[model samples]
Target: MRCRIPETTLREALAAGATYAAIARAHGDDPAAVRARCVALDLSRSRTQGRIPPEPVLRVALAMDGVSVARLARAWGCHPDALSRAARRLGLPTDPVGRAALRGGR
Candidate 1:
């Protein structure tokens, strides 16, 4: 079947920051059947999800001499990779210097 979203519905959704693709998906698939065109979808989050600590807190933890990324991630309720990515993006080291040396990498 074809999809027909009312103009008011589309306008309201867009004004509320909903993307066209999101609205299209909500209207069901087969968008081409109705000649509906939507902006490309980007699935990545604008901000990372999970309980990543604030910069100062993360800095203190990363600054600790013997802390491991895995341990930090566990304590912070995030995956190790997520923590690492967040740290790297913030220009902080993902691994403590001591642990990096122990792992034989900088």
Candidate 2:
């Protein structure tokens, strides 16, 4: 037997920026079913809607000392690959240990 998701719970999850797959997992339903329901209800927010903006991420990368791209990506709720690309494009260092060493520390 399949579990039925309540409309209110679905709406609340979407409003809280939960992805379809996440919502489906929490509700014990299929991701496709959650996506279709969201579409029908006009409640879907883009996957990137609540994520940190790229420009600010770049700024943080440049301003922070000894921060790795992977660490920043985790903190900013984005992919490490995306942070690495942004750091490269912005001419910022991507390795934490190397950056620290360059700054005259471990």
Candidate 3:
């Protein structure tokens, strides 16, 4: 099952550099639940054996309806280009639409 964060707020918080655990705390959800949504969104690259990383956090932010990669990267204390490269390195689809396409196997 998917996690319980409101898709909109998850995006907002993520863009603000909130970790999955912090986002979950903000929304009164289990951190694992937050991680699940990140996974479902393909925002998470690594398997869920450990903590969710900043890369996935950026992914989720970029996947939000109006969030931008540059904005999220700045919020996360990194250069936009670096975050962009990290997303690519983690095998995350850069475009939100492309990520969505992945989820539905389109």
Candidate 4:
């Protein structure tokens, strides 16, 4: 049987960086069911072990000039590698990259 989770609840959990398995355990749903529902709804979140830093947090940190990923990672109390992994999942630049490079312009 498919598990049903409210969109709002799922989105909130996702925005909070909860993994599918974690959300499943918390809501008494099977992990596969949560994953299936997410796929059906076209909802996905990038995360590492434990709770990942929210997308907004990563975006703001990436947008800040003169801030290194390592520095931000330190401030966020997570390893730099974790942050990098999540950024890669979200297709955002984990390092400083020129706009040209990001857009394949150069």
Best by lDDT: 4
Candidate 3 regions exceeding 4 Å error are: 1-55, 99-106
lDDT of 3 by residue, 34-103 (tens): 9888777766533222323466575566566666766666666666777677788877776878767645
All candidates: CA RMSD (Å)? 8.2, 5.1, 15.8, 9.9
lDDT of each candidate versus the true structure:
0.64, 0.68, 0.67, 0.76
Comparing 2 and 4 on TM-score, the stronger one: 2
Error of 4 at 85 (Å): 12
How many pairs collide in each candidate, listed in order?
0, 0, 0, 0
Whichever of 1 and 3 has more lDDT, that candidate is 3
Q: Sorted by TM-score, highest first, which candidate order results?
A: 2, 1, 4, 3
Better of 2 and 3 by TM-score: 2
In order of lDDT, best first, we have 4, 2, 3, 1
For residues 1-106, what per-residue lDDT tens digits would candidate 4 score against the true structure? 5869998888898888788999999989999999889878878653333445788777766777777877877777677889888888987786557422444533
- TM-scores for every candidate against the unseen true structure: 0.44, 0.47, 0.40, 0.44
Task: Indicate the TM-score of model 4.
Answer: 0.44
Encode model 2's per-residue lDDT on 18-67: one tens digit a residue.
Answer: 88889988878999888877777787665332254466556555456756
